[model samples]
Target: MAIDPRGTDLKRLLSEDQGGPVVMLNLLRFDDGGREMYDQYAEALSTTFLPRYGGEVIYAGEGSTALVAEAGQEWDAVLLVRYPSRSAFSSMVADPEYQQVTGLRTKALTEAVLQVTTPWE
Candidate 1:
């Protein structure tokens, strides 16, 4: 239900940092007409914010048939975004320009999961 990270969430993310890059796994469930809005946000992110913050979209795709999930667990879309570090990601989200377009993302999703992943050693 939470579309955006809260201040506490960002603080925790920073406090838990082990250093190095972080990949964010985003599972999205959209509202009606939400895809279009999300696309707009994505465009700005890919073209501007991501580059500014040393991040990139590793993978992004619509969800397909779920072979191993509960009946109501299928996501509408998924994205893997890699950031140079947790601080980079936190800073991006805090950017004033990014804040202007963040409403699009918030309005677009009914539910989402933004999980952090670190590569195995």
Candidate 2:
């Protein structure tokens, strides 16, 4: 039921940083009528905040039939977003303007998984 990251979560995320670019994998489950609200948030994020923080969406799409998964494990959507670094991601979340619109994202999701990824050589 936790939609957004907390200060402790951010701290832990940053503490695990390896000082390199990071791609975040977002698995999202929307509440009823939540996708529309998330769409609005995504627009603002993609247009304003992402560019400002040197971040970009690598991929985003609605979730499809699961080829292999446990019951109740399917997501509504998935997003892959890249940031210059973990710190950059943290900064964007900390931005005052970003904070203004953060509620939209929080309200839109019933569940979410935000995980950081590193590239393989």
Best by TM-score: 1
Write one digit per residue (lDDT tens) for candidate 1, span 1-121. Answer: 6889999999999999999999999999999999999999999999999999999999999999999998889999999999999999999999999999999999999999999999999
- Model 1: per-residue Cα lDDT at residue 55: 100
- Model 2 regions more than 4 Å off: none
RMSD to the hidden true structure, all candidates: 0.5, 0.7
Q: Write the per-residue lDDT of candidate 2 for residues 57-119, one digit (tens) a residue.
A: 999999999999999899999999999999999999999999999999999999999999999
Shift in Å, residue 19, candidate 2: 1.1
The local distance difference test score of model 1 is 0.98
What is the overall TM-score of model 1 with all chains considered together?
Answer: 0.98
The most accurate candidate by lDDT is 1
